[model samples]
Target: MAERTRPRPAADGAARNWLGLPAALAFIALVLLVDLAAAAHAVLIGFLALAPLLAAAVDTPRRTAAAAATATLAAVVAGLPSQTLGSLDHLLRVAVVIAVSIAAMYVARARTGREERIRRMTEIVRVTQRAILRDVPERVGGVTLRARYVSAYQEAGVGGDLYEVVPGPDRLRIIIGDVCGKGLPAVQLAAAVIGAFRQSAIVRTRLEEVAADLDALVAREPASTHGVTFVTAVLLEIRGPRLRVMSCGHPRPLLCRAGGSLVPLGTGTPKRPLGLGGDRGRPDTHRWDPGDRLLLYTDGMIEARDAAGRFFPVQRLARALSADSPEEALDAVWEAVRRHAGGPPRDDVALLLLQRLTPEPDTGGCGGPCPG
Candidate 1:
C-alpha cells in the first residue's frame, strides 16, 4: 500500500500571524484596564501595550500599522470615560502618540529591508562559488569516484584545497592538490593548477610530463597580488587494473583491497614542494584489482593534531575506509579528522576516493585496444 504524506507548513509570515493574534488581543485588553484620569501613568501603560505591534512589524508592515492603530484607539477609548481634558486635547494627545509609533515602525521596517538584502546577496555569492568549484561526478574511466571538500572558515565558497579528474585517450587522469596559502590568493593558484592539469592531462602521455607542465605554469605566472603562492599535488592515472601515481610534495595516497587490507603507496619520505624549480622524479605505477579503492588527500587531513598534540596516523585512516560505501567511508574519515583537529580545521581539507568498478564481459567488435 502507498503511504500518505502530510502537507508542509505555510510560510513564516502566515505562521507568525497565526501565533501573534492572541497576543495582540491580550495587549488591547490590558491597555483598557489602565485608568486615564492620571494622564501620565495612563499614557505610559498605553505605549507599553504597543510593544507587540512593533515585533509584528518584522513580518508585515501593514499588520504592524494596524496593530499600532488599534492600540492607539484603545488608548483613546480608555481615556474617554475618565475625567481627562476636553475632546480636542484628548484627540491631540492620541495623534502625537500615534505619530511617534508610526515613525518607530518605519525605522524598523527600513532596517529589516536592509538586512534581507544582505542575506540575499550572501546567498547569491554562495551559489556562484558552488558553480565555480562544482563536485566531480562518479565513473571516470569505469572507476567510481567519491570525494569531499570542507572549508575551515564558515560560509566560505572555496578554499586552498582542490582536486580534479580528467578522462583522457590514454588513461583516467586525476590530481589532488593544495595551495600554499589561503583566501583569494590560494583560490587563484588552485584555479591555475586545475587549468594546467586539464590541458596537460589530455596531451601528455606521462604523469611526470603533466607535473612538469604544471610546475612551469606556476613558475611563470605573476605572483598573486598578496604574494607568490605554490601548490603540492599528486597526479594519478588509472588504466586496465593498474594505477600510476606521481607525487609533488603532497601526502602519499593509500590503497585498500576488497578483502579489507590497506597499503600506503609512493615513497613515504618527503619530496621537494612544487613550483620551486627542483629536480623532478620518475612516476610510480602499481597493480590494482576489481573492488579495490584508492584514497587521495591533502596534508590537512593526516596532519590534523588532537588536543594531546598527536597527529592523525595514516594507518588509522586506512582502517576507517573499510566501510560498505565510499561516501560512508569518507564521512567517517572526515569526522575522525575533525575530532583530532579539536574542532574545525585551521586550513582547507580535500579527500578523494576512487573505487575500481568490476569489468563487464567483452562483447568483441572492431578496433585496437584503448590508449595506454
Candidate 2:
C-alpha cells in the first residue's frame, strides 16, 4: 500500500519563525474590541477579521483553525458575556469566517499541485530531447571536435538548427544546417536531416552526394507534398591532408590555420538551399595542413545584432577562432553573439568545430586476405 501522504506546509517553516501566529492573535484582539459594543457591525468586522486567518491558513491550515477557535472563544467570553443576543450573533459571525478561511486554503493547495505536475512533465520532455541530440564526441578521425547549441527559449532542447560528425570510409564527414522555421515543425525537419545524414555520410564517399541524399529525403516526406522546407547546410569531409566541402545555401564556414591565420571557405559564390531542386552546385576542396581548424555554423551567429543594431560580422568570428582552441573558439563565438543580441537569442544557433591532429606515422601495410 502507498503510505498516506499528509499535505506539507505551504510556507518555509524556518523563514516564518513563529509561524505568523502573532499577527493572527493581534487581528483577533481588534475584532474582539469591535464586538464588545452592540453598535458594532459584526458582518463587516467578521470579513476584515478573517483576512489574516485566511492568509495564515494558506501557510498553516491547522494553525489557522486553532487561532480562529481561540479568538472566537475569547471574544464570546469577554465581549458577549452580558447579552444572550450578542452571544448568538458572535457565534454565527465566527462560523462564517472559519468557513471562508478553509475554502481559500483548498484553492491554494489545488493550484500548487497543478503547477508541480506541469513542471514534472516539462522535465521529462527535456530529457527525451537530450537523448535524441547528444553532444558531438570530443574526437573524430584524426581531428579534435567541439560544438555547442543554445536554444532561443529557456529549457528548450534541439530546435531547428543541427550538427553532426560521422567517421567515413576515407574521412570524417561533418554537417551543420538549419531548418526553415522554429518550434515543433522545424524540429521535425531537423530530425529528418540528421537521420538522413547519418546514413548517407557512411555510404557516399563524396560530400556532394551526401548533401544530395539529405535533400532527397526531405523533399520526399509526406508533409512536403504541398510545400518544402528550405534547409541551408554545409557538408565537410576531412581526409589525411585534404578537406572537401559542399555548401547548400548555408553560411560560409571559416578555416583557422596552424600559424594563426583566418580564411573563409566558399567565399566567391554559394549554392542554392536544399529541398527545392535535385541539381547541386560544384563542391570546394582544400589541403588540410597540421593544426588546421574548421568552423561551421548556422546564420543565427552572424545575424545577431548588437546595441547599435550592427550585425556580428563573420570576419570578426574568423579572427577570434585563429587564436583559440576548439572549445574556447566555440565559447568566444557564442559570447560575441549573445552580447550582440543584448540578452537571450531570438533564434536557434548551432556550431561545430574540427581541429586536424598530426597524422600518425605509418608502420607496415596489412597483408592481403587477412582474417575476417
Question: lDDT by residue for model 1 over 1-372, one digit each (tens)?
Answer: 101112233665566666554456566675555544344534544454464454455545556666666766766775556645346666666776577668756855776688678667656655644644556777766688887777665454467788888887647898999888887767777888887888899998878888889988777767733336677888888876667777888888898888888887775454556677676677676767778888998988887888888888878766678888887888788888887888866767788998887863333322222223
CA lDDT of every candidate:
0.71, 0.68
Best of the candidates, lDDT = 1
lDDT of 2 by residue, 284-342 (tens): 76665668887888888887887887878777666567755776777777777777788
- Model 1, C-alpha of 213: deviation from truth (Å): 1.8
Over 4 Å off in model 2, which ranges?
1-107, 359-372
Q: Provide the TM-score for each candidate, comma-separated.
A: 0.70, 0.71
TM-score, structure 1 vs. true? 0.70
Instruction: Give the range where candidate 1 is weakest over 10 consecutive residues by summed lDDT.
Output: 1-10
C-alpha lDDT of residue 309 in model 2: 79
> Which candidate has the highest TM-score of all?
2
